[model samples]
Target chain A: MDFTAILGAWIAVGLTLFILSFLYRDNPLFKIAENLYIGIAIGYIFSITIYNVWIPKIYQPVSNRVFTSLSNWVPWVSKFVTPAGDAGSLTPLFPAIIGISLLTRIFPKISWISRYGFAFIVGYGAGLAIPATVATMFIAQIEGTIQPVFKLASGGAIDLSGPALWTSFSAILLCLGVIVTLFYFFFSLEHGKISKKVTKIGIYFLMVYFGAAFGTTVMGRFALLYGRFFDLYTYRTSGYYHATPILILLVLIFFFVYFGKSRKTSP
Target chain B: MKNGKIAAAVLAAIFFASVSGASAEKKKIEIPPLEGLTARDMPYDMGAAALLEWKIRDCDNQDMTYRIFVSSLAGTGPALRSFTEAGWIKVDEFKGNERLAKDIELPFWAWNASKNIHAVKVSLDNFFGKIQDGSVYYFKVMTLRGKQISESPVVPGAVKGNWFNLSRFNNLFYVILISMAFFWAVTHAKKGNLFIRRITGLDAVEEAIGRATEMGKPVYYLTGRLGMGSMSTIAATFILGEISKRIATYDTQLKVPHTEPVTMTVCQEIVKQAYSEAGRQDAYREDINFYVTDDQFAYTAAVDGMMTREKPAACFYMGYYYAESLLLTEIGSHTGAIQIAGTDAEHQLPFFFITCDYTLIGEELYAAGAYLSKDPVLVGTLRGQDIGKVFAMAVILLGAIGLTLAHVRGWDGLTRVIGNLFNSF
Candidate 1:
């Protein structure tokens, strides 16, 4: 292996072990790894915000034109700072102001100013989602469900041909599932005999869905575990020389961290 | 005699040109008049695009090629003849014989105009240069045969954007219907008592907390990454308040580790409010509910480590979770805690199912607090949702039967009628 590949593998193995140690118990090594993970994650997110959010939303638009012929006043600076345009539209300023206002919440004296930011977000979210919710979640979903559950015969009878038979049957099943699921969530209605039967049928569909979901989730987790195991197996490189030291380190951890803890005086 | 014949021929050509100056250039060919030339401005948009459509006059003519030309602010009649340049978008070749050209990449919009006619929809987003709304434009389709040229009448079109789209009238109708149902339910709920079916999952909430109190271990509540403006988080917050109230009476600690600083602040308030309401205000501690790192997996690791070391007797996994669902729950389970998880994250449901003792799935999590609280405002909302479902059932049942009847007995005529009826949204 090259130096970079060898170094990357070593770091990965070391961090994985540091994290995995928590399965046994939380120790100084685990804490160090956890802190490092948080620091790196926060640093990465900050960079992304600058690259994705701040530049596009705030910096470039304002620098291009601060509402007037501000760029023309300083030719040297404007040549470097200004974007190629007559004047940038002032619409971007609203979001920029709101974004800056979110930081004001940290100051107790003027924290109430942040309410405008929160209010804008909440109001915008509600306004945006209501129409979308009605269209997609309510209408479109119903439209999908309400379509013909069975195929009609040429003479106005049901189609029983092999492919058509399965298609029509599954459509009927889907229609049933939708109806029963809706019925199951009907809190205001008392579950009388018919309602009970319908809701019970709903339960069957729900169980099948949950079962399939569980299987998929297991497969996903197993895939991740498999990937980690494969990475560890690559340590067999350089004629098995690295494997011996790694095994010895694990042995030391078991002896000192696990058994040694037990040997301490009773609390 | 030959010069006299040429003079007579020139005189006939001049007479043809004077009748209508259809040609300024060299050759003139008889091009068929294009059919149904129209432009439509898309509704509920920012006045950005215009739809241009024209039927193929004689699509079968093997020797002819068609080219679409557009000019901004090109007027009608004599003024149009004076206009010099007609910027052409594309030229389609007549491939000849029984073979037809394959369906090329079409410019897309919310919906295509129709199937029978040839269509071209243009907007600022797709058109070559500048296309401003409210500006008058002209379109003409030309026919070319060898070196000869023939052109369609100049058709004027202007884009008109609307604030509300009539195409989505059904969507608005649906919204109105639900709104009426909600308002009626709320008004009626205010007047008198109404029946609410019991949600049994909520019963586990109290039991889990009670078990923790008995063991004298703190109850841990992980709200995942559900922040403000999410219904799931709001519901979880309500449930957290209730849990806190119960735990306060028993003098047991409620530990809430939040990933978001904003959520942590809100949770702290909810916890304090619960203690105050329970008449155990002295028992409330601000430090018990605290902010953790906003990092996704890092937050999960912190919670997992805390679960291992502290071994909280009751673990509440609420709001939304992604990959951390299994990790947190598995770690909590290893500590032998009574874990109750409620989330709207569908993909994380299966992981929660295996590890958590009692799981509230999908909409169940949304309805938990409303059901538990029994407040008229919350209950009224649930009632409205139920009413909407009934409306949906009626629509679906009727649509299904209508479609089936249309499909069967080879009555395709029934489909067109019903399709137009149901396709408003």
Candidate 2:
């Protein structure tokens, strides 16, 4: 292995051990790792925001389209020109105009101009999302719940018929159950015997659904944990190095956390 | 030079006029018939899904209208039959006034009726027509302008096939993880390790409830409006089940206000069951686990009103919460109630940490249910998660060192090796 390769491997091992020190107890090593993680994550996010959002959406488009247009049309207009002190400087005017409008948001007296920009964005987003939400969420969910269930006959030959009468009946019942249950929670009406009974049945269906949902969630968590463990075992078995140094580092970090906690609590 | 400039200008004007005249003349063009229509696998996310794309011969856009027709390969009619036996049986049917779109997906349910279907047919029609069964049908797309119809080429439908074998791999991984976790938990339990879980939030549950009893005030518990898919809700429900039992023993009043009607109903049942298990079913009140509203801010407003009116001495905010976390917690704080909150939402963790007396972070929320119930299945899963965490730590350290060494020493091979390892799974 090359020197840089070995160094990279060692750093990975050290950082891993540092983070794991928390399992034994939190101490300086764990603290350092935690700080590094936060710092790196923040830095990455900052750079990503600049590259993806600021550059493409704000800087590049404005400079290329608006500034270039101004420069070609009104060259030698010194006052309106961009990059300042240049004769053909209308390039910076576009961003400046936007900046001025945004700055108005900070001033209480001039904040009304900011509403124009906010209105445009909110209106556009709502216009696009409203139809999609109605189609996908409301319509699709209703369709799914209304679909009749089917069962196979004892002969095992594929039955090519529509859902059984009972299945269709149950689908209607479930739909009613959900609706009535929803009505029970409606605050406009006072609690009554019929509403109370409907709500009680709704509770039963809710429990079975929640139980199944809980089971799925447990599966998801276990999957994440399993994936992590798989990585650890695979890496260790790769035999990149003696692994003694990493083991010693972990042990030392654990000792520090244990001793530090003991010292803080001692009478 | 002046003469040459004038000549160029004249030529340019002539060329532009001629080009415009030619484009206007092209408007009377006739459309060609469509042909070679076919449907195949879409490039991406093609599992259980296929794209049916066809080419129309008619070049004019005005004459392009296509109607898609689907029929069972088994030539079975649109009759309802028993799932086991295949015969026409009439059920309910709805007739619509307007014609439906020609190109649409026929979900799995539409197929499997009969194996005799040869092909699907598409046709162009101003009005919807009745579909005949037990016959191979081909679709014809045509353009309609006024009463004129320009027919396109016809194409047949193909049989639907399985998209991919995703279930096989998923099942394999599920079995492995479940077995591993079960074995570890069983082994540990048998060895009597007395697994000491570090859960400061759970430990403080008693203190919070007791304070409410001392104040002679009811304790309020809320499981946020997040649907059943949320892990936080599961943890909250399990914890609530345990807490309900404790409150029953103490004979202290407990109120749980829910946002979703379904969740409210579930909470009521869970609380009732817990109280029954504690042999104090008499103390259980159905109205306590009541539903508010589904509207987010509106629900928050209702909850705030309830909190102010009831003035519960203790509040437990558990499960998935959004922007309302702070609003709820701040109001509870104002009421001088001791609040303990737990959530898996990374964004809301800061609010819980600063406002609540005790907070559970990330995986700790999952551990809460197992810790309280000591359910073998849950405990086994937790132990398995611990093993997974340790494994993750090891990988992170190894990967870091490998990367560092490669960067410093210009080890191209080592870097490649590390990259391959990361991508392998």
Candidate 3:
């Protein structure tokens, strides 16, 4: 509503139109917008890492410790120190050292030393991941998959009712899906006549899963598209002095002129 | 008038008797006692926390609520003498039948499997600034029903951390089993007896490269933003090595655009070694492997622009991809390039499947390295992993059957025993 806000909306509308121009064809406007997006994203991530990771984990801790220790030596120095609750531990230095060692890759002579850091990282990650993967992905998955298909009826016989039968059928199908899917990925086993049929069944299950996932993701993409279009429509209001329509009209003209001239220039 | 007076007197007498009978019932009500009350240091964790457990003698009447209180000894010996009721602060309160021991999700080995018992955790550090290991703490459970209250005798507990968690024993057993399997398979593979089934995606990689060679266009390989620590990235690099070697033999230009700088450096060495192995080191260029920005969509956009401009004949997207999977593959699809993608990211597989010519789902990506290299040692690991999967499948089938039988026969104990085998912790 204010001048700066209106100006911001205009800029946003202009960038959005420029980006959307990529759907038409690659042009200077799209390239400019792409480069700006990348540049701004990189800068934003850099500042975020500095504030969130480096300052809190490394800089503040080390500085607080140093200032606290210095303040203990001179009473007047207390005023200069940040109000840290306690003298921070030097434990963060160990990881900080490892992190700095990673930067040694930039130097050719000491690049090999970075291998120690890489080994530490990879070793620690594997050691952590292997157990978790076995537990959550392997054992827990097995536990969740092997549900009881047969339910006891109130008369103490296998349930024959419609709802119970459906439940049992679904459970059996799930179990079958798991078995066949696992068999499909089996490399050591030869896919003979019967094996091929089983694997085919497995492929059907996988296709179903992939199809469901694809449909869901398409819906998500459409939602994103809808959001962008809604923003464009909102900006067309007089509150922003019809910024969307103006920028879109300009982008359309530029696309036509650019494509027409490029076509003429081509041999 | 006489009949009315007699009827009213009888109604008044009946109402008074019913009211007195209700009052008698109220007077006869008694508070249920808390039983089997115990407090101890919680197992499989660092010191400073205690587990309090008790059972209400009669919980069928669900109106009862419980309050748990804890009081910590300030110091050892004489310091403990100063402990008073003021030190006992309420830690938790819950309605009856809530916070049952069975609701606590500890593995069977670590948990006391009493479903009827109430379980509550008390942290000693909540009272003391920093609790010492083996510090003595006392806890009490009080039951409140209507206006009636009954308290359990205070029990002393000592907090001490355990060295090992027995709850994760199953996980450890599986890890060891797979490791042993790997070693045995590797030794056996030395005899050249292992058979790894054909992965059609790896086979397609050759045809894709041939197409690129004939078209005289560069082949692009993009590794997603995961570092060397990721298994998928390592596998991708192995496949890259194999792919690069074949490309060297064909004398086709190959470009690897990396999101992570470390992966780029590693791939450079891998490609160099591959070229040397192919006896085409002279054709290898240092610029083959290059760094791109680590941001996901930005990298995808940059690659999209490049793909549109050059219209590469073949694109290989490997390693762990996120939302960028579809973005890159969709653009490559537009270019009509033969896109082959391999990744362990399950969610991104849908995107790759729809857009790419060849897609490797889940473990197929892990197997791509060994399949392409035909290295017996790596092939042996694949056999070992397959053995593990077969073991898993057998267990799933057997467990399902056993559980189904247990359900039909009403064997709850057997059901639990079988179910616990597959529980993680």
The top-ranked prediction according to DockQ is 3
lDDT of model 1, residue A84: 55
lDDT of 2 by residue, A205-249 (tens): 645554665466557657966764554444453454634355556
For residue B409, what is the lDDT in candidate 1?
51
Docking class of 2: incorrect
Best by TM-score: 3
lDDT of 1 by residue, A1-267 (tens): 467777777777777778877766777778878888888877888898898988776676676677345656655666555475546566788987886786786797987777687668657756666787677677677667765656766666777888888888887888889889778878888999998999999988877888888788879889998987787787646644475358549746765966577668546
The sequence of per-residue lDDT tens digits that candidate 1 reaches over residues B185-276 is 98888877778887666788788888888999989998778676566776788888878888898898889998876667667768889999
Docking class of 3: medium
The weakest ten consecutive residues by lDDT in model 1 chain B span: B98-107
Q: Rank the candidates by lDDT, best first.
A: 3, 1, 2
Best by lDDT: 3
Model 2 agreement with the true structure over B1-425: per-residue lDDT tens digits: 99999999999999998897676545423434444555443222222332334432323343333344332222343543232343222211112111222223232222222222212222311122432222233333434443444544434433233454332332234346545865876677655544544577888889988988888899999887685445567678778898998899888999887766445645666798999999999998878787655556556655665676678899999888877887688778878889989886656766676678887765677677777777666666666665543443344445555654564555656655454333311
Chain A (candidate 2) TM-score to true chain A: 0.64
Which pairs, if any, clash in model 3?
none
Interface DockQ of each model: 0.47, 0.01, 0.66
lDDT of 3 by residue, B292-363 (tens): 677877777778888999999999999999888988998899999999999888878999988999998889
Task: Show model 1 residue runs off by greater than 4 Å.
Answer: A24-27, A72-86, A152-158, A239-262, A265-267, B1-31, B35-41, B46-49, B56-117, B123-163, B279-289, B409-425
Ranking by DockQ: 3, 1, 2
Q: Alpha carbon lDDT of residue B416, candidate 3?
A: 78
